[model samples]
Target: MLEKPVNEAPLADVTPPRLEIRNLHRSFEGRAVVDDVSLRVMPGQVTCLLGPSGCGKSTTLRMIAGVEMQDSGQIFVDGKLICDTVFRVPPERREIGLMFQDFALFPHLSVADNVAYGLKGSKADKRARVEELLVRVDLLRFIDGYPHQLSGGEQQRVALARALAPKPRIMLMDEPFSGLDNRLRDGIRDETLAILKEEDTAVLLVTHEPDEAMRMADEIALMRDGKIVQQGAPYNVYTRPIDRASVAFFSDANMLTATVEGALAMTPFGRFLAPGVPDGTAVDIVFRPQHLRIDFDRAGQGPVPTPVDGTPARAVVERARFMGNESLVEFRLDHDGSIMKATVPAVFLPAKGKAMWLTIRRDRCFVFPSEGGA
Candidate 1:
């Protein structure tokens, strides 16, 4: 069981965001796709909207880019109201650059011409700007290459360069790396982030991968069926999820239900003292895999205690899996069929089906009321 922190910072800030959505709503076929959603994207920061498929993340992004009309609410970019009930701005006039999942490049146009297509300047000036953007995106050598001649990663870079041609104030990316393989995706994402940071462009990215969001975002907004359930800094959301779904999606956690007894919790595994929990209250504890350390004794040791004071519940190892440099062990409790996952160093990994002792760090756990389903 983790002890709750005594003090935490407030989530909302007083300063205005560079991009703001107020009471945003959208619907299709009488079904609400984006229902009463609101968010803020700070200048020069990457904010990721994450959720499962059909969760309205894409709808929200399209609405912000002016590609889709909102049924209600207002959208402001840099304090300029671009969307309202009666007033609607076309996508071209929104000062927002968009990069789609598919690299939508003109097949007949050269890479350089594609990048220069949207610039409002003389021919020579436009060509010069295109060359600069191509170099910034690390695709200067492929300026003359056609879309078919370039690799997937190369094509993605060209598309990004084209989006940056107008030097828009904000960029909207819809799963820009989802089409590429894992290795290429990593490299391209890094390059893209570097270029965006250098340009200081405010970006709102939509993706379903939690790891991607954790790795690339300054802030994350977790959405459900058309509604944002939680939004905060990456670390804040990971360490302190507001609900069970957020907790499971953000990390690998062993969730167990128990009832609080004084400061202690009584579960089938054993009794544990959980700080900040009221007595007689039913609660669920989220234990991260990294927080638990397991040690297996080759020479059989005596049975491990249920609760090791100052820590959380204890269990014996039921199985262990060797994963490269580390080992993942699953433990079964003495009192219940509940299982917990723990990651330990390869050197200290227990033998498969062997008995091992487990200890959970109290400071690293998160507790919530037992409300069932993840």
Candidate 2:
């Protein structure tokens, strides 16, 4: 008999998710805080829990860190059950590191001592680990200095070093970069991500800032009203949003209302295909500001229609502002007199009341069934 090929050999190298949560639920005063939240973060991956305030992002992190007990559901680390409704693991015993906005460094202890706080083993081992982590964060020279002697960014580095000293399987960071100055935030974020990736730790970071999430996350979990509405790669979540709210969350969105007929939604510019939506259903056609094209008017008439951009519509510029990288121009359409916004990649600030033709890229727009409409 011929030897059978073993499929398990190739899959053996495929590492399982380092952290996993299943159907996690928490409620406050009969109000659901985190409802049926489920997600997974693989080793060396940075997953950001992104949303506005009061979205239960912090609560989810707290639960994973074993600081807050989930009302229901299970938490797993490397496929091992750690916590659920009844079974639990103490925060200290969970092998999970936490870095919050506040550095929370020991005021009385030196940098070396702070980093070595969670470490164990012989004195020499602890000292070596402390020195190694301090070196990683480029704070080795300040090992003997106390927390107050350092700046906010330095303190954050120390906090990160301390958190990683124990080699936790999962790291929970709640807006750790929020306290740093704008100039320092980017640099520190890059450095921290590099260090965490090197350590192969699964990081679950919580932040309300979309830019931060887009910059740092390998995967983004977009939460709203205590539930995750969408989760995917940053580009996928941004480009292929599931709903109007998801689109508006990332950037300025231009929307127009229309009713579906023959699987198409008609607008002033053109028709948008709303496949799967029933006929006679009201829908919203949405597109980002960048997708709207501006053109010069020709004797009060706009440009002819094209396959990709559909039709050009006449509009009057209401306002224009050069926002460093791009220019934002708002207009009032002549057909409907409704406000619409567009962005130019360069400085092309037209004066207010200037007449301009507008066209939307048909391929870039999204059509969704209107909320509260059948």
Look at candidate 1 and tell me the lDDT of residue 167. 91
Task: Summarize candidate 2's per-residue lDDT along 25-125 as a digit string, tens digits.
Answer: 99999999999999999999999999999999999999999888999999999998999988898889989999999889989999999999999999999
CA displacement after TM-score superposition, residue 42 of candidate 2 (Å): 0.7
After the best TM-score superposition of candidate 1, give how far the Cα of residue 138 lies from its true spot, in angstroms: 2.2
Predicted candidate 1 versus true structure: per-residue lDDT over 6-83, tens digit per residue: 797657856567799999999999999999999888788999999999999999998998878899999998888999
Q: Supply the global lDDT for candidate 1.
A: 0.84
The ten-residue window of minimal lDDT in model 2 covers: 7-16
Scored by lDDT, model 2 comes in at 0.93
Task: Report the C-alpha displacement of residue 180, candidate 1, in angstroms.
Answer: 1.6
Clashes of each: 0, 0
**Superposed model 2: Cα runs more than 4 Å off:** 1-14
- How far off is model 2, as Cα RMSD? 1.9
